[model samples]
Target chain A: MTALIAFDWGTSSLRAARLDERGQVLEERSSTDGILQVPAGGFPAVFERITQGWPLHGATCLASGMVGSRQGWREAPYCPCPAGAAELADHVLWLDDVPGGARVGLVPGLSAREAGVPDVMRGEEVQVFGALQRLDTDHGLFVLPGTHSKWVRVAGGRITGFSTFMTGEVYAALRQHTILARTMAEGAQDNTAFLRGVQHALRAGSLLHGAFSARALSLFGELTEAAGGSYLSGLVIGEELRAQRLQNSALQPVLIGSPALTRRYALALSVLGVQARELGAEATWQGLWSLAQTLDTTA
Target chain B: MTALIAFDWGTSSLRAARLDERGQVLEERSSTDGILQVPAGGFPAVFERITQGWPLHGATCLASGMVGSRQGWREAPYCPCPAGAAELADHVLWLDDVPGGARVGLVPGLSAREAGVPDVMRGEEVQVFGALQRLDTDHGLFVLPGTHSKWVRVAGGRITGFSTFMTGEVYAALRQHTILARTMAEGAQDNTAFLRGVQHALRAGSLLHGAFSARALSLFGELTEAAGGSYLSGLVIGEELRAQRLQNSALQPVLIGSPALTRRYALALSVLGVQARELGAEATWQGLWSLAQTLDTTA
Candidate 1:
């Protein structure tokens, strides 16, 4: 039987896991019916479609991410840092009688304010929290790579702070909309060129100037169009690594994401002589499970 | 009446001017028929349409910029620096007995390769040469801001070297294609926010990190959507200026463009404690005039 139905809904996709009382996932399901893909307040139906055959119809639903943003199913205001499971649980936005009679608790993401730079993360906070729990470390930096890559800090089981880098979005935008679009060929990625890009970023000091190298290298025949995408990816990621000061930091970084993305990030970190450990998507599940546990205790 | 037909043909628009023997603009005409908009090798036809009814239809034609690019009317190969009017004239691709009985000379852009970061400029070199000539500076830096902002070093009436920064393109793509799109508003720019963005970039160390601040501050209620675009612009221009090391540079910058762009760029420089002089679109015309002079001597 499903003890909990935990969902990690974002802008582009939806993922849900049915877990037992001990937070062990019994069954998992996912769909591309992201909140944005569905009409406003139509999330319950999309959730139903994804969970059609699941027996845990009435289980408590603990959700995180953009689903709780102002534009999502409900607005779960950000829980300011240093935020832990306890702080997030206190702000969990509860929805009564959501489809299938499941009571929904949308977990609030964490926010950080610094000198003139304010940042917030929606779904990645769950991964960061789960990363902290899985690694069983009181303190360590965690990197969650996605459209908006996050470099996060956790101390005493709380999200101390984090910054968002527009690395992946930049790659996509340049490839699809800019002059680089004409030069980047899509197909099998070239690892050798990617590494060269990483090396170039490490050596080049500024991204404002470094990004043009994508076009320059390709135009000059240094990098074939087929491999330029990978090179650009490496360059942007390398810039991210440098900007975040992740390279050669005292504390090793724990990268949380799918195998492919984390692997690329791990490769980049290794290139910079910084070792990083990769965690699977299960980390996100565990994070939702932790939030479920917090809600259970509070209730 | 019509002694010369000089065209500043760029990616999105084309401007052709008729000048007397003294290089005075007797009449000027423009069209949206840029090189990119024309069909393959259809530049002659577009030129025909723009020059209709002009008595200078049979006059000597000098076209600079993308019109000579690989995808342009014909590939006018780039002349490596330190190239001046004489070297450029020698390398200019000549087309004999074209439509309207006009011989065409396409001005070649300058290319620089340094430390694996290759740079190229197409239409801006004209402005750079003209700015150098107009400002009467033997040795100084010139900044031409656009999709690809060029920082040039000219000495003794020759183009020594230059670097291209993908500043404006990144800003456009990030606003149009990325998550930041949701947070940016168009119309009625906010200069205060733009200056603030410039300040943030000056203080922040990384463009990858700093670009996110436009969205972040808006999300945190520090910036309105309408003002966010200006801030983003300032961030990009600030990043561009910083990457080119204008803050502490001894040589004053020469800003080239239409009035609006140059004004903003000049403001950005003054904010950084650097003074910059503005040049009008006539600089480009003067540039073409100089190239026209070079071709005349050789012809």
Candidate 2:
């Protein structure tokens, strides 16, 4: 029987997993009914539908991501960081009135202000903790690259601070909505083109100027239409990495994302003479499981 | 009688000026018939309609901007820089076969290769030359702020090179299409917010990360909804200025554009302790008239 029903719910998709007492995944399911898709007062029904027939008796439900955002089922206020599994367990907003009395908790997202600018993250925090658990370490730097990439710093087992980069989202917007779209043609992954873009970005110093190169290079017949998209991807990801220089930190950075995203980040990071470790979605599950374990002891 | 019918044509609108023998604007008219709006092979008709009663019997008609693009009435291959009035007059793509037997020349745009990247501009070349003629000096840095802002360099009576930054388009895209839109409200000009954003961007060092601050700052109530758009504008324009550092070049950059846009640019440039001279649509008219004068000399 499942001991915890854990979810990594975000803007576009909802993923649920049934974990045994030992935090081993017994079964898993996902759907397009992410928090954004849930109508007002519709989360309970979608929750029940997704978790139907699963043994809910004595099971604790916990969800992370935009599911806790202002638009989610219920607002779980962001927990100010320097936070870890213990801090997260304490702030978990419980939805006890869930139809079947299923003990459900919405994991509060983490928020931090650095250099007078506030930064926040939801689902990626879980992935960060999960990577820590998987690696059996308390201190590390973790980068979760996606629509909003998070570069987190974990010190003495807590997320001290982090920064968010709108790299992927900007890339998509420019490729689809701007004039650069005319010159770019989506094709297979071109590592050579991608790395070249990364190199150009590192030296270019301004994204406003560097991004125009994608169009300019194409106009000059230097960048082929087939490789334009890849080159653009490299420029964006490269800009992100250029901002995150590892300033003599002894701990190597761990990149947490899907294989495709992580691979690109890893390649970009490699250009700086820094080797990074990559992890996948399993980190989210592990992070949630670790938080769930803490909740068990506290309750 | 009008000596010339000069056009400053672009992507979204067209402006026509009837210039007397001395290149003074005798009458001026405009239309929404930009190159993109014209139907297939509709340039000649649009031209005739816009200049319907204007004397074209002995007037040499000339056009500048996207009207010379491949998708325009005719593709005028971009003239390589160090280009000036003489070079532009030499490369004008003449289309003498128009139905009305009106002699016409499509002003070629300028193209430059810098740091192994190619940069091109269509109508702005005419504006640069016009500003030069108006200022009566050849060596100066010219910045034309618009959808695609061009920063051009002139030396020894010719435009040596230039760079284009998609600052305005990127701002629009982020405001309309991205999550940042939720935090941003299009309010009246907020100079405090604008300068604050410029200060933030100058310090932020990475646009991908700096852009996210628009959302993050709003999330924390540090940036108000009313001030978001202005702050974003400052950030984008700041990033552009950051890339084009003056580098001890003893020339006050000339800004040519609509008053609203040039005003923002002048304000942004002021932060760096530089005063920029401003120009209006008159520059384009003067540029076309200057080129037309050259045609008279060489004819």
Candidate 3:
């Protein structure tokens, strides 16, 4: 029998799960000390504090996210894709200087060249792998949407390639800082405006032309402040579709994220005459778990 | 001798200049209570507080910028192009009830509809008109670089049309809020990086393609953090050129605003194979003054 701990460390929070031999989470704990908040040199101590008294006398710790960044404990070099579980497992960096003598394994991020564009993915690789484990097909597109959204193509349990969009971050900035902020109505409601905006972008046929039209529509009272968010969402997603069209249009997409975000992606994909399937949150969590299983088998 | 007071009420500050019959400034006063800070119903008191004892017992008050916006004391309806000083003077709105009993004349903002794109200019309209007064040419592009940078085309002393670019605000947000902020070195020291960025953007051929290159170049070490600002500056300026290329290309542009901004614009324009002439700040102020002159002559 063996024990292990898996961590998903992001910008805002650090979440760790204690897993048993069967790859089931025994106990889960999270901390506020994410990459952004924790001191650069304090990663080791912070990790120790989180995993304290978790019965880890002889267990390997698998970590991901900003923890593997340049500012993290030690830079785990990126494993460029078409990378699989074995490649990720082989590239895991082991820390020798932990206080409690715990062996630490850091998951390697993926980097790949697509259409002459070099793209990189960190935590999402594990999640993509996790989602692939739950699927029957070997080939499909997987999307992870957040601050920096990613669209990945997976085949045979390996990440073939991916693309990242500054959609969420741009949306946040536009809604809070730019003139578009004034047009945004208070409170979160249904994405009626979002759908409308997507349709508008589709009709406009270009992101640049569609984006400026948001301001024009607002100025002309065609779109209200409450609907500005939807309009912007449409503009960005529409732009993504246009860019993708310039690249290739054969493959369909599967979205992996929170329900709300996945729905938005689905709506955008639907507008472009593409079908998208939602990968449940549990599937993503399981995707990471599957990577942990691979590590266990290797050990 | 007729007396006039020109008030430039923007988002952050208010400036009032008392002028003589020849449009020479007799006195100037300013306040921090600008349109953004003032309450919706507090313009009268704010105006009274700033313009107190300006010897405007019978002087005409010519106001511009956000002060003539919808939230201002009175809405100065937007006048469509080709707008002229007479149109602005005739359409000027007045404060119906004022404690000081001053003859307030709010300058009407200029608006235009061309190629299905509608644009408007308020405070800058006065400045553009003022700049035109000193120019002998009947047609040229007038560049006003600010929070919402306006690239205006004028002919025959009338405002023909203009395009707005959100360059300054984008710079501020990117520097203060985004991941690019962390990578960008503090303070701008060299125009070398900025100018180089402009050249790269001009070469990339499209604004969107050029923008992504900023990130790619930084990652590839072709761009340094210290030069990120320049890269950004180049991207925006490049995008402006791409947008402009779709419009007219023959007319040389007249650069307006501060020395630094004009210099940057001049450099970008040169990179895009366009020759530009530097116009002075006095033009915008003088444009407002000229509008006041027209009001006086016609009244």
- Highest DockQ scorer: 2
Residues A1-299 of candidate 1: C-alpha lDDT, one tens digit per residue:
68888888988888888888788888888889788898976877887887787764557888888999988988898899999888988988898857777778888888898784788889898888787788887788888888888889888888888988888888888889988888888867778888888887876666767778888777677778888889889899888887766566666889888899999998988887898899987888888887778877888
Model 1 misplaced regions, further than 4 Å: A1-3, A45-60, A99-102, A294-299, B1-4, B45-60, B99-101, B294-299
Instruction: Write model 2 residue lDDT over B184-295, tens digit each, in one string.
Output: 8769999999998887787777878889899988877899999999999999998888778753445689999999989998898888888888999689998998888888
The better-scoring model by DockQ among 2 and 3 is: 2
Report RMSD for candidate 1.
2.8
What's each prediction's TM-score? 0.92, 0.94, 0.79
Best by TM-score: 2
> Per-residue lDDT for A71 in model 1?
83
lDDT of 1 by residue, B75-183 (tens): 8888888988888889888887478778788888888887756778887888877776677766778888888888888888888998888888988998898878889
Model 1 alpha-carbon miss at residue B2, Å: 6.2
User: Cα deviation in Å at residue A232, candidate 3?
Assistant: 4.1
Task: Encode model 2's per-residue lDDT on A81-183: one tens digit a residue.
Answer: 8898889988999987786668889999999976677788888888888998999999988998989989999999899999888999999888988888999
Point out the worst 10-residue segment of candidate 3 chain A by lDDT: A201-210
The ten-residue window of minimal lDDT in model 3 chain B covers B204-213
- Give the lDDT ranking, best first: 2, 1, 3
Q: C-alpha displacement of B239 in model 2, angstroms?
A: 1.9
**Model 3 error, position B170 (Å):** 2.5
List candidate 2 stretches off by more than 4 Å.
A246-251, A296-299, B246-251, B296-299
The C-alpha local distance difference test score for the whole of candidate 1 amounts to 0.83
Interface RMSD for candidate 1 relative to the native interface: 1.4
What TM-scores does chain A show, candidate by candidate in order?
A: 0.94, 0.97, 0.91
